[model samples]
Target chain A: MNPPSGNAGAPLLEFDRVTVRFTDVVALEDVSFRIRPGETRILMGAAGSGKTVLLKTAMGLDRAASGRVVLMGEDITRRPETELFDLRSKVGMLFQESALFDSMTIAQNVAYPLLNQKAIKMEREKMEPAVRDSLRFVELEQTMERYPSELSGGMRRRVAIARAVVTKPPLLLYDSPTAGLDPITAHTIMALIIKERDVDNTTAVVVTYRYQDGNLVANFRYNPNSGRLDPVGSQGTNTIFMVLRDGRLAFEGAQAELEASSDPYIRKFVKRPERDAA
Target chain B: MLDVLKGPVQAVQGFFELTGRAIRNVIAKPLYLNDIFLQMDSIGVGSIPIVLLTGTFTGGIMALQLGRELQQYGQTDQTGTAVSIILVRELGPVLTAVMMAGRNSSGIASELGSMKVTEQIDAMRALGTDPVKKLVTPRMLATNIMLPCLTVIDDFIGMVGGWVIGMIVYNLQSLRYWTTTWQALGWSDVVQGLLKPFVFSFVISLVGCYFGLNTTGGTQGVGRSTTQAVVVAAVSIFVIDLFLGKIFVSGQRGL
Candidate 1:
């Protein structure tokens, strides 16, 4: 079969048979998927099923032992880190643990990316507005001077989101952004993600265990006219679902198609409604 | 048997690899000089009290023991010369490095290890900053510069402690004791004292970073890395001193 293509042009991210291994454990095997520009792809999987590994692989944080990763129209599977800098500048990744620098205050954490851009050494005055804007975007503006250790779990995740998007990167990768949050906080984070997608036309790949959250992400579209999210059509082109089982791609399609899949593991995954995914 | 050797061999290779990367980053852009200054203050200033105590105690003890031993042969006057030579030639660099190996090496390992386990290092990379340059380089450079400076202070304080003991305990004339000590210290002794700490600092920094970057298994893994950093750095201090001591000894004999 031919590789997947975008509706407008080349796919923004394409994983052609990517495989990763750590000793005897196979983190990913023959994994393949594509996410087009401005499209949100939700990666669904059970624990140890390669959900987080796939996300890391896309960002070049984990090297694939075989196959290719085509990112931003460039094959970066084996590229050296120096060459990946420009590509990474266009991509923002939020880790599973809300990995804010513990020693830095919330503002410094948010401004780190902008200040480190191509080693340009940005001045504090220039960095202040961007940091303030990102903090306000995450609704954590009042906690700008607090260190990561001082923030609550949910607050740290929000700050992580702010830091990820502080530089206005076009592609956002979120690894379980709502994993440990309360319902209200999770909803808020999900809303902010959709807002980013709508306002910035940001393409994103989210790793999630909650099928309901994934459904909410895949089925909703933000309408600026009403300032509210509305459900997309049954055949919406904005979102896609990719499911993995035992480190291989088991299913990749719309939410309807996923619920209809006959594979027992896929069926089991669809059966569980509000469970946590790895 | 091969496996036993392999661990050390791989560790040595890893140390060299990190050192090479750190040096390249030193010459690269975005040096993170702020972190360098912060570390210099922390490692240099934070350590002054302990180093001071160690220096004074060590110097007084060296003079006291030497004075007693030499008096058995009616050579008590040589105690000051002996203490100055040992302090400048060996004790200053070795003791200061051992203290750093215990303090700064473990600190670096635990900090990096925690960052590794928590994904902050990975996040830094995703943000377009290199962890080696942003995190490790500043620390390595700071400790490298400060270790030598501390050794000089240790040596100077040690000489003064020896002077107190020489005058009060041994009853050596103050003028004679100072003259002999000054005469005993050649440029070679100063070079040896500085050179050892400079090299020892590299070993401590590189080993600490290696274990920290490779940390796994969780918080337990961080503890393991920290312990490994201190043990390896401390042992390496002695091992390196032994080899470097031989080199200086042979050179002196040849001269």
Candidate 2:
């Protein structure tokens, strides 16, 4: 059965009536959202509004109290953990903190997914080119042998992006991918995210609190043939923006719809400073 | 009061759950051999000097103290018997176990707690890596292999310390001291020494992993887990020692 919020065709992810609680607090309650194939859904919420939890829940990193998580035509809400590896291999998640294993080098971290899978486990030398290519994808090829601790905040996040997309997973879930970086770094990270979604046709679930970040990904289109991000007219309507507030989906629509929203909370959230507006 | 009972019960439940997962992951496919070897180096080879130092001082002191009693009765030759017997049957294993609980257990807890705080552990789960297999199992296996090895090394070093005392300080006959030391130790003593460390390894590593995985808050939580690991393992070592001692003693008597 198609869910209430599900888009046309089989959705890559569906959080049907999902609720998550931590003791007395409710992080997410009866939250349902569907991400269809080739669609980018930006999950944005204020700090502590549970955007990260929603992103993690979709990846099965966080448990839901009572809900059905249907993924790619299968109900996996109660799927056994052993079976989840196969589920996870199809989805790549970038954490808020990058979460690169500090014990490993950039190359080693990027190669982690390749090394974990049994069928794909090849010799170290054989894995090098793919690992290097992933690093190059994020424009950090020179930092391959360096540890995560050695890199700046932005560089580590880029490495994390490289690691996330190295396997070329069909679904990419990013939690604040560009949250803490400077403008250039944030833009670079967003460009890579767009490239992955647009060039590779990867379905994406991006979590961010900044409206500009959401607008940035929706504004640009990656022309695979041209190998560059070209400004799209009307942002192509392929990207769906969402605002989560108080454990529920408060807003869901296109960029224009979100910008035009009259809801007071959304107004305050979407309102830009005088410099940006001017 | 309800919360009090609930906390311990929940902790014990989580502890067993972690233990069961470690057991399953140990025999499962795609074993993390590199991690296991790395942990072996950290827990076993890295612990050599400390274990040897602890053993030597402990054995030397025991010799000095017992030498006084034996000298009073002109039974100085028998100091070797007493020292060897104590080191083999109790001091070597117990001492090494305590040291490991302090060193390896706290290290594991702090490392894992920090990871939990930083979301690296969750990151691993999201990336399709079971932290238990990639992280816990290797440490468990490493501790299991290394603790016994550490106990053996401790016992040997302790015996050397006793020998140094008997030959030089006490001015006892080398041949007599060596003979009594060997004669005082039976196969049972050796097995007993080795046995307790196996039990202690499981206690220390599992407790550390347990405290680590359950950590909350931030840096403070990591520190709590580290302290909790050491305290729990130290207390547990004694409790486990008591029970294992009872069983071994009765079994030896039966034999």
Candidate 3:
């Protein structure tokens, strides 16, 4: 597979023959996937199709019972928790519920990873600027001092995105970024995600169910000026991977290929349910 | 025969698993130092007043009862000695352990248990942090260190209780009471009483944290673990006390 633009060199992370088992259930089976240095990879799956487990394995939260998780060319499947900490510092996660610490304000939540960072000795001095920058990235600069409970769901998600990206990690993992949001708010969040990747060249692995038809069609257009294939239009063109039921790779291609796909699963995923189906 | 063999086999397996986890945790990072310090503040510092109050009252009651019994036999002078021996050798450590099992052990178990059920432990792991180091180790170290210190404090307060009852209530001379107590209580008794706490602390903390870390089924599991921790710790302390007493008694006869 051709590497995405802005990811000119080698792949930054890859899961080779990864298999995650939870007792009798196999969450992910023989899953092989890769994300380059600065590409956004979408992982699409139904509720229990193991999207969350796949993300957990990459984050080193779940052990790949039999395979290898290669990050920066280092096989980190069985690394010690301490070593995994260093690896995790280079990646950020935005959980489905935002998972903002209820006890902390938005600013404190954003500064949490920085506080845990062993590299930052002068925590008090460095914390404010980091929090400000992160909040600014998600356009949530004003709500820094407010608690998570005080914020709306959309605002909380943005705060979570801010916290996740605060560390300025090269890789970002987002779980259901637009699951419970109005279309406008979801679009706003998607735009912010696109902006972050374009401006900072950060690699994003987004797991979401919302697949806009217009966005998919526009993503197929090749930009001759940049010499890159845009997946979800020029505004957000990154690699996409879809996982289906029964441990099947339902779709694996650019936005163009996915838009043109005739597979029933892919069609069902991309198309809006008709009035009869609804 | 089958039941008997099955019980022993299961017990052995549990012991090995517990031992393996502890060893793995110790070798993992030694990150429990700060956590242990914080836990010491919670378990030892917080429980001081209650343990002291209970220890003192129990000692006073024992002294009063013993004094009444000895007075009938015209052996009233031995009341202080008897009270002191009981308080120092057994009652002080055992009572304090039970008190802490109710107060500190239950709290630790429930708090950690709730955090486990809520996916906070999973979050910690996802962040590339060891939950054992961050949550369990400090608690274990804190309870182990603080329980002994609390036992010593309880012993002192208990002795004071006996003195107050003997001198004021029973009209016994303070000097005579002190002399009898000092003569009857040897360094061996103190050492044996103190020794039990160090072992009891380890047992209480290990059991409390183990139950907390393994808790599931949500709020109900947290509640269940808390109750179980107290019962287990209290029972284990008594068992350890009996064995320690036998060892001391045997050693003294040999000496």
Candidate 4:
């Protein structure tokens, strides 16, 4: 039910022995994981290691051949398309390529989810402000009128992130949010993701290849407010850092545990590259 | 010779694969009539103006050319009968199908092809929605229903075009042209013209969507598939028309 209490309680999102097979290829095989409410779970894997497939499965984009994708205690497998729209509305996804509609302006792109939902039709008038607020949230308010083709790679990703979070979904799924960006820009995007999780109490599942020290530090913050996310030194905020590899839980527990991990893969993952390697 | 045979073999294989996919899709999820109606609006209603203009001009040109030739025998009065018969029985359906193949079939192919190239079709599948039901079936049903309707429109327009040329250029009376055309042409001529387009519609849509769904590579692949779909559909229409014409005309002569 809650993240900071460790893996004792029910998780907000759980994959129970999920498998995805495409002809001769098994994209994911018997993959299982759990992320409790208010957790920032990191799915780190090498390229072609099924991180994207895992994220897609959780988002209900990729159906598992066998097993269940339980979201908030409900098995969403075989859910009707109409109900899937509602499920999708509750989870926001940022694709690696941004995948913004080229025909739409930044504001229109951000407001897409709102317009797509019939339930939000009466609230259409509020879409503009929501778009503006989401853009402002990502620090891209001035680029609202620009098309996707007009934006830089970083700007486009931010716009995509803005669009994904515009509906203020409880779960935010990000596929390589900082991929193909410079180090500084990648850190900035990661910081924004951290800020969103803190401010909105949004549980985030980010699939990425980069493992930076600052990102690790950001993942280990402790705040005391509601055990979801509070400012550092706040009364009730607790953070747990996790890493998944080869479609399984590779490393979990406190930041100190990860730092002290003598496992070769964990050591290599946590090791800061020497100046020569850099 | 072997290399040339390769293309046909590949095409046949692709056709079989597409048919299998279509059958599986239909079994998985069936398309509704409302979708067919919307597609009819796209393939038929939306295409009417172009089909009319092209059919009329083709009819007029045929009449003008044939009129000049027939005047040598002072068989000019028979021009109305000849033009009406040809237009209603053969030219109308064939020409309309060819034009629709260029317009509606190619457009559908290109649009769907581009979506495939861009992974939008894959995106729909990932969302557990059948692209054939959502995209292809409606268009196919629409084309099947609308092609015959377009043929009827083409028949009406073609006759009017022949009448215009007969009255204005040849100094024939409009009333005489209509009476001669009506007396010479029968329900069978109209039925023959109408029948071919229904079959042609299926060929155009199936080939178009088939090529589109299987398109790969990038924008260039989409463009190539779109062009190939139109060419294949148009050629198949004429070939199919020739056979249908033989059957109908021979049956009538035997009668």
Candidate 5:
């Protein structure tokens, strides 16, 4: 498939039959997919179905036991950790738990990627403003001095988002960004994600259990002029929906194809009450 | 049958791997000097009160018990010598490490375990910072540097406790007590005392970090790692102390 940018260059991420194992347990098995630049891929699965593992494998945080993973045109399947740092700096990831350093304040957390990423070389004076700008992007500029424990879960997730995007990488991965949030809060989180996608035009892979979240990503665009999410229609967006079951990809297709899938496992993810009729 | 041994074998292998990585990170670029100082402040300065209290009482107890034994041999004035020898050569290092194993080992385990379960360590790596270099190496270096300092303070305070007991309880002269305590410690005894805590520091930090980084499950897993870190570190201290003491003894005997 062509990327949203219509750049027929190399894909941003490609997995060729990737498998990951922990001891005797297979976390991800023979999972193959290609994520092009400016495309958002939404991955859905039940708990322990390797959604998180797949994201980690893509980032080179977890090693692939077999097959190959080419990220940003580099074959990272067998790349040593030291060599992967520069490549990883170009790809931002939000862990499932927010994972902000408990010891650091919100500003410090946001500045972490900028200061630590070897590929990023901002002047020291530019750091605070960049941190402030990032936090302001998340609408949490006032919470600079506050530790993560001081913030609510949604706010902490936003701070994590700020940290992830501070470097302004071309690729982003969000692991269960809206998990454990109330409906209103979940919508807010999803709106922020859509805003990140529209403003930067960066490729994203969102791991989520809620089909509603995926539906939003696939069906809406952030209208920068109106500062709101506008319906873009599924055809207007370059998004793919993937469903994993028991360490294997059960389904991978467009929203219409997913909605028309006959597989029970794939149907289970799309069976949300409010969106059932759609 | 081999399956039964796999768990322990893998654990030992993992521990060594982590130890090697941590050691290498000490000399690697991007040394986390700030983290090392922070750990020193926490692990070193935070340990003073317990070390002081334990040292003082241990010396007082030794004097009270060993003073009578010395009196029976017409060597009541020798209380300082005996206390100094035991405290400098054995008790001070082992006891300080045991106490630190109980305190810092559990502390490091719980802190790192919490980070692991919450995926903060993974986040650190994801952010282009190696967790072992940022987390484990600092603790290892700080513990290695500070355990010996704490041992020195413990030995000095223990001798002071012995002197107080000798003067007040045994009615011995202050000058005699000072002289005997001063003369009792040989170079080998000092070397043995300093070396043991140095070795125990590695056990304390590495075992705690090992269990912590490997923690799974959730909060329950953190608690389990904390308990296991303390237990393994404390046990390893005693076992290592026995071997070290045997080596020192064999050397003294020219065996």
Candidate 6:
């Protein structure tokens, strides 16, 4: 069944009445949403609002206690972990804290998915260029030999981005991609997210607290020729804004609808365009 | 009453579940040989010096103590029989296992706890690698292999320590000491020594992995898991040693 929120053509990710529980705690309660091919979703929520849980649930990292999650047209809910690997390789995820392997060099971190993802079988000779190209996409090719601890926080996130997209999967999930960065660095990370979207035509779901990060994603398009993010007019991006409140989806619509939201909790996240200009 | 019993019961269930999966992964496909070797270096090779030092001191102290007791009966020359039996049948396996419980169990818990808290383990799952296959099984296998090897070395080095004491303090004949030490061990004692370590390896590695994977609350939680892993594994070693020793002693007595 098609979700009312998404555009036409089969959904890339669809959560049908999914509820995730941890013993007595209701992490996600009957949450359902849909994202069609090439659509971008900006998920905003307060701390402990089940945002990360939703992302993990979508990835099949955490199984749904009830209902079903369909990813790329496959029913993933209750699928055994062994079977999930092949399905997970078709998606890329950037964790909240970067989650780079501390023991591995940046190159190894980026190369991990390529080497380990059972579906992506590239020879050793071809692997290095893919690793280098992935790092180059983040503009950090020179730091390949360095460990995650040696890099700055923003650099590590970028390296994480490089790792996430190295496989060039059809869908990318960024959990708080700009969560802990300075304003300028957050912008850079958002710009990279947009660039990946525009370049690969990849579907994305970005979880963030910063309304500006969502705004940038909604209103900006990356220009490959200029190597910069260009401000786009109304129809340039197919961005859906979602607000999660206490384990339930409170809002799901376009930027205008999100800004027009009257809910106080939702308003706390919407930073209206007047402030965006200031 | 059931509420009070629930947490520990679930913990035991979860631990066995983890142990079952880890062992099954031993024969499962996609074996991570590199990870296994890396863990071998970390758990096995890295443990050598501490094992050697502790073994020497423990053996030396046992010889000193046993030699004094034998001197009471004018049987100082029989120090080899007492020392070798105690070291092989009890001290070697128990002491080495306790040391590993302290060194490797806490190390595994803290390392994996940090990974867990940082979401690296989740990331590992997302990247199409089973964290248990990649992390826990390798550690389990490495500990299983290494603990026995370390125990043997401890047993041999301990005997050397006993001989050292015989030569210096007791002024006992080297040939007689060596002969008694060699003949002191029966096949049962050897099996018991090796068997205890193999069993203890499972306790040490699985306890560490259990506490680590279950760690919550972030950094402080890592510390708690580390402490719990060490304590649980060490206490378990002694507890299991008592039972195993009882069974072996019973068998020898034809009970």
Cα lDDT tens digits, model 3, B1-255, are 897698557655764575466646766654667666778898889999998899899878888899999999988899778988898889988899889888877887888787777555665665545667767667767877788888888877887788899888788888888888889999898898888887787777777777787687889999998998888878888998999999999998999
* Interface RMSD (one decimal) of model 2: 1.3
The lDDT values for all models are: 0.86, 0.86, 0.76, 0.75, 0.92, 0.92
Q: By the DockQ metric, which is better: model 3 or model 6?
A: 6
- Give fnat for candidates 1, 2 and onward, in order: 0.80, 0.71, 0.29, 0.02, 0.83, 0.95
DockQ of 6: 0.95
Clashing pairs in 4: A223-A236, A223-A237, A224-A234, A224-A235, A224-A236, A224-A237, A225-A236, A225-A237
lDDT of 4 by residue, B78-127 (tens): 77888888888888888888989999879888888877765556444432
- Number of the top TM-score candidate: 6
> Candidate 4 has what TM-score?
0.71
Query: Per-residue lDDT tens digits of candidate 5, residues A1-278?
Result: 21123545679999999999999999999988888888899999999999999999999989999999999999999998888889999998998999999999998999998888888977889999999988988889999999999999999999999999999999999999999999888888889899999999999999999989998888888997988888875356888888889888888778878888877888889854354212
Model 3, C-alpha of B126: deviation from truth (Å)? 4.0
User: What does the lDDT come to for candidate 2?
Assistant: 0.86
Answer with 3 or 6, whichever has the higher lDDT.
6
* Ranked candidates (TM-score, high to low): 6, 5, 2, 1, 3, 4
Comparing chain B with the reference, what is the TM-score for each candidate? 0.95, 0.98, 0.90, 0.90, 0.98, 0.98
Sliding window of 10 residues with minimal summed lDDT for model 1 chain B: B3-12
- Evaluation by lDDT, superior candidate among 3 and 4: 3
Candidate 6 lDDT by residue in tens digits, B201-234: 9999999999999999899999999999999999
Number of the top-ranking candidate, with DockQ as the measure:
6
Query: Model 1, A158-203: lDDT tens per residue?
Result: 9999989988888999999889898878877887788788888899
Tens digits of per-residue lDDT for model 2, A130-197: 89888888899999889999999999999999988888888999989888888878877888898888
Docking class of 6: high
TM-score of 6: 0.98
For candidate 5, write residues B1-255 as lDDT tens digits: 999999999999999999999999989989999999999999999999999999999999999899989999999999999999999999999999999999999999999999999999999899999899999999999999999999999999998888888788889899999899999888999999999999999999999999999999999999999999999999999999999999999999994
